[model samples]
Target: MNIEHLNVNGMELAVVSSDEIVIIDTQSALDLAMTVKYETNVANIVIDKNIICEDFFILSTGIAGEILQKFINYHVKVAVYGDYSHYTSKPLKDFIYEANHGKDFFFVATRDEAIQKLTETQ
Candidate 1:
């Protein structure tokens, strides 16, 4: 869980990069907004997705929504990386689909895809 702070649009974006997973733990809407604002400039955040825990299923979804809402508010784009196949809940799956389809949020299976999606300019 290596975390680093980055400057994006004059806002601090915390970036956590690891061999197992890379999580950008946004402590507030401003943190999320900053991340989305410079999502494209940051690259190769996570090399693998196997480090993500199954327990993060619900928390991750909630965080994604929160981040997306902030991104929408600021008109920015961001990508979330993790595997959703382990989850058996139908509603959670629906939420994931909805977030992925939206411009502000993207749910991906691989780190590469995550970085690509995040970096893509909208």
Candidate 2:
């Protein structure tokens, strides 16, 4: 895993890039936020969607909201970047659509888009 601190539009963010899959449950989500806050001292972060656990996309488990709520609660902004076209669930699609439009969390297609959206989100 490669963690890099970047300044997008003058705002600092910790971006994590990895080829290895990372499972992010509610606890891990909090841990991630804490790591960014303590290690990088950045409130915003971008993660490659490919590293996220597959279970995260399953809305029925309530994992998505549980994890995302932690990010919001901690005031840690985040952007998930990758292709979401493979997911056909309407609820998931709707969730992504809603999140993309909102400010707290975003689902984007690439790191550049994620950085741009995160910048706009602030």
Candidate 3:
């Protein structure tokens, strides 16, 4: 995994990139956030969606909700960026739409947009 730190509006953000899936479950998601916080002292993170397990996008599995809840509990804001147009589940689409309108979590198309979402004021 490669972690790049960026400062936007005086807020530190960690951009995590990895070739393999990093978050296979809720525990793994929390671990990633904790690792980022420990390494960079940043509460905000931007991760490539490809690094997350495909199960996370399946709303029926409840992985997305569980992982996001862990992030919220730990006060770790995360922005996941990638191409999500391939997902056809309406529930997943609605979940993404709702999350995008809120703080702490975001689903966006690019790294730059993820960074923008993370750095924005609450």
Best by lDDT: 3
Q: What lDDT is reached at residue 16 by model 1?
A: 45
Model 2 spans with C-alpha error above 4 angstroms: none
How much does candidate 1 score in TM-score?
A: 0.53
- Candidate 1 yields a Cα-based lDDT of 0.52
In the range 23-64, model 3's lDDT, one tens digit per residue, is 999999898998899999998999999999999998889999
What's the best-to-worst order under TM-score? 3, 2, 1
lDDT of 1 by residue, 1-122 (tens): 44454544444333444565333433443453445336534422322334343433565456645545655666555555666687788777888788777656667887557655555532
Write one digit per residue (lDDT tens) for candidate 2, span 1-122.
Answer: 77899987789988988788764688877877787789899988999997788999999988899989888888988999999989999999999999988898999999999888888877
lDDT of each: 0.52, 0.87, 0.92
RMSD per candidate (Å) reads 6.6, 1.0, 0.8
- Count steric clashes of candidate 1: 1
Q: Give the range where candidate 2 is weakest over 10 consecutive residues by summed lDDT.
A: 20-29
Predict model 3's lDDT versus the native.
0.92
